[model samples]
Target: MPKGVVRKALEGFQPYVPGEQPPDGEGWIKLNTNESPLPPSPKVIAAIKEAATDALRLYPSPTAAPAREAIARKFQLDPTRVTVGNGGDELIELCFRAFAGAGDTVAFPTPTYPLFEPLCRLHEAAPSRHPTEAFAELPPSLGPDPSPLKFIVNPNSPTGALFEARDVEAAVAASSGVVAIDEAYVDFAPRSAVDLLNTHDNVLLLRTFSKSYGLAGMRIGFALGSPDLIEALDAVKDSYNVDRLAIVAAAVAIGDDQHHRKVVDEVVKNRTELADALERRGFEVVPSAANFVFVRPPKPAAEVVAALRERKVLVRHYDREPIAGWIRVTVGTREQHEKLLGALKEIL
Candidate 1:
């Protein structure tokens, strides 16, 4: 074999492993991915269809004006402090590129969205993983080096455990690093750390249309921060990071608050029912403020996952620290939850 040319940084990079999507399946219940079971608001669908024309020949707006305006209005933030991305994931990678670099360190809680560590490595930043205590608390210190950027997931992925706003406030106040609060699931949660933005210049809040708005395929997400930080991200991002269709879709989705609330309420209902059932089945279910439940079943989580897969039901199985034996299941439709619980009973 010929010797291949690759950067030294590429040698040990471990990429994020998102949940799988099987190609061929019938009657399969997909609960592994945390996507909304609901469809995009009818208005959003109409907007996308309306935009489908010869206009695609032209490049999307370099600024994504309409979408940014909608996001600003919906979130009540200044448009100058907002920047959209291909998705929330891209915003995260952009943060590493803009802030943390060689010799710099990035710290985030363990059992989080796994992309943060590899993103740090790809940017040549020394990424540090701090294991959350039994109750899922950020560690006391920043370790050997001060992290220039700190990422935290509110209603954290997989574990679905929400950090209290007070605790988050204290952590952000204590840290010298820029605190990036990833509120990907905040629509389901009762509160947000975004309120801290008024007082903390170092805080950045990220939002996505993929979950509550049911636009995952649209690949639209936005970041809110101080103008200086927003400018840094904008300088680092491509001239046009968001596309035309996504911008249109996201704007329409944000405008229809009524539909958004209806879907979220349904998901919240299902989430509660699913969590309660799991608890009744002898599982230790975490109190989730997100649209999913992290449950430690009496049976081995891996085995339960495997059995559920065999029965055509899919849920996430984690092998990471602090939550190794737990499973993270997205709250599907009411019918989907009933089907899942029925299968889980057979497996258990």
Candidate 2:
């Protein structure tokens, strides 16, 4: 391990920072990561248990056909147009590998997903950032000439701001290269860009079982696009990316629409209640379309975060400009929300 052996491209690379996960048995109210508060469908649990048998002695299907087919059936897409992955994060990296090359630029809006830039750096691709207050509008600079590989996180993370389907369609129509819409939180939004799939071949819609399906621990996600883009992703991804248990769980979860809808409804209800409560406390709460809300308290964000931690309630705080003063809170169950609000009341 010599210092000079490191790649020059990674000279100043900064890794993505995920939300903090406190240790188990810490008696902490976890509301940092945007995981569903509800558990997965009983059918999903049964499927996972059934899959955890002697069958694991064999390799999983490299193509992940069953899970892909289940996702396609859910979205009314062809099996050839779906690609499953270990998680949405892996799918993002696959997009970078399949489409971007050295010196090519990968573009995404700032204050969106934190992983996009790091993935671009990992691929030795130049990173281009478009600054936006909220993700309600597309960057005017995105078009055919520069032709960068673009990633858009609908109902964006941290901010929880959502862009309309028409805005996404406009971006796809104008882009020369690929346009990937990370719909990881679209289950809680009013509409999805999947409706534009038939008309746009350049758009890739990414979904995860982690959010609404309550399969975050399973680490299963999928992407939908034209057959060509899906083929490219399949070719670049690691073989046997989705394990047997994860595949079975995701398939069952996707097929259980009633369970998924009920969880999403509950999250949406809690989100509204939490936002209203925050606003009533003299905090400026941004309207959220996802399962989290971004709020700017009267005090500095770092101090507020520390205070919350002291009270054994955890939320997320970023150290970036324009958003450093804001904290992102995931909407948990009603009891969790009550605990969070009570903590905030004391802190404020």
Candidate 3:
């Protein structure tokens, strides 16, 4: 390749870094990613196994109607109003493609999901980051000229802080363009923006089967919005974006409300217990509504992360300002938490 042949916008573009996954799961308490420590429902597993037949010879449904309808039924929305994707990440990128363009602005709260800014940059859109506490305090003039695209991670990631539905509704009302609410962690929260879809045509609620449903390996996610917004996403998303096995697994998983509730209840319980324990240990832990806790330990976050790694217990650590000293720990199984707590005791 010739020098400088790449697009100028690609220059200095930084990618989103995900949680580290050690090659082997042996002897490691993996809690960096907010994945459910529990396994998927038996029905979901059986559904995937059933789907792995000679059907692989043909292409899957382009619209992924089975999974989409299941999601709609679960949320009590119309099937036409939901668009399933490869994952929540793809749905997020699709929003940028369908709504914003180069030089358009994308807004989100800082110290939230790290992927949003990179997606904006990949599409050459300007990124506008606001403090999470001040996210709803948008200027009156923000909706006019730039036609900003907004992204909200409800029960926001890394920190697990949740914004009330009223706050989100107000932000959507103030926006001229699309507002995508990433609700990957909403099952652990008290409320959801799905209710806002009834009143607001500009709002899109993104969800995943990864966290609550324990289908991370399947990589299925979806978006719920007005029919118009759903159609827009469908227009830009790749045909057959969600494969057959994933569609089957997600559909089965979505239908099993009992199993979903069981997993979520367990995680929420563990989250509370873990947060209380961390607080008791003198860590300034942020109250979380998701399946993780953001904590400011007694020592530097980098040092703690390194020490934990040495002890084979993993947690997320960020190296940015404002939240640079804090670490995010995914609420794991009770036994896993005990191991993490033991490791922390030794490290501290």
Candidate 4:
């Protein structure tokens, strides 16, 4: 607790704040975090249970080979091009270790992923933020930022706005550093930047089982890129960064392609319905490619958020510039959306 005991770089660091996780079965309609509106594939659950054996006493594959192989097969990429992580969030941190460093600049568009700014501070790296306007466009300066590492959150958070594949490729092509395209929500979107991998070795795509796969609690994610990039991620990753059960869960989840498609289909269908419902209520809903809708409510976002909390309805709100007065609401089932809409009607 001593003032000087902590690292100098973390002297006054503020950590990333996640969404409210109220106790389950409390009658609260949770819509803050972009969790899957459904449970994970039954196969993933069964596999995890089967893997919970005396073998747990042994350490998991340091490289998470099974998961890497499964992910590679799913994406039709070579196994060497895959690297599994605790979550897509961990992969973002590892990019800092593998590419960016102290005093190095980490570039990304402003107000993309809030985690990036805090991670930059945690790693003692400088943040090179470029601004985006109207529909969450990629920052114009991003392509020229000579930072050692850069990030692009496709189907970008909060705004949920997706960029053109050509535009994203242009940025990656122009960049002089490692470009990480965070596709954590791509399964809900129309296109992916995976093709950029064939043309550019410096581009890495981060995917997660949390959103579309409904495995947030399992904490499984993977990266796809050139073999060299994956090797660097492996080098910087913690030993057994992903646990045995999680690896099994990932493998089974990836194998159950039918379930994966069902999950995406449901979320995408519900996302469209939810966005339309919000717009009808006079909320200026941003065009979302992800499983959430970002909108400016007709009233003060802070007030609306607080009122909803009083009614046990949770949604994320922003008070900062640019996105101030906007709220991000995760797409839940139709029943949950009804509850949320009812609460908004009462509050308004």
Point to the candidate with the largest lDDT.
4
Give the clashing residue pairs of candidate 2, or none.
Answer: none
Q: Please count the clashing residue pairs in each candidate, in the order shown.
A: 0, 0, 0, 0
lDDT of 2 at 120: 77
RMSD of each: 2.0, 1.5, 2.1, 1.1
Q: lDDT score, residue 8, model 3?
A: 83
TM-score of 2: 0.97
Report every candidate's CA lDDT. Answer: 0.86, 0.88, 0.86, 0.91
- Model 4 residue 226 CA deviation in Å: 0.4
What overall lDDT, based on C-alpha atoms, would model 2 receive against the true structure? 0.88
Question: Which 10-residue window in model 3 sums to the lowest lDDT?
Answer: 135-144
Q: Per-residue CA lDDT of candidate 1, range 211-322, in tens?
A: 9989888999999999898889888988888989999998899899999999899999889889988899999998898888888989988899999999888999987766
Name the TM-score of candidate 1.
Answer: 0.95
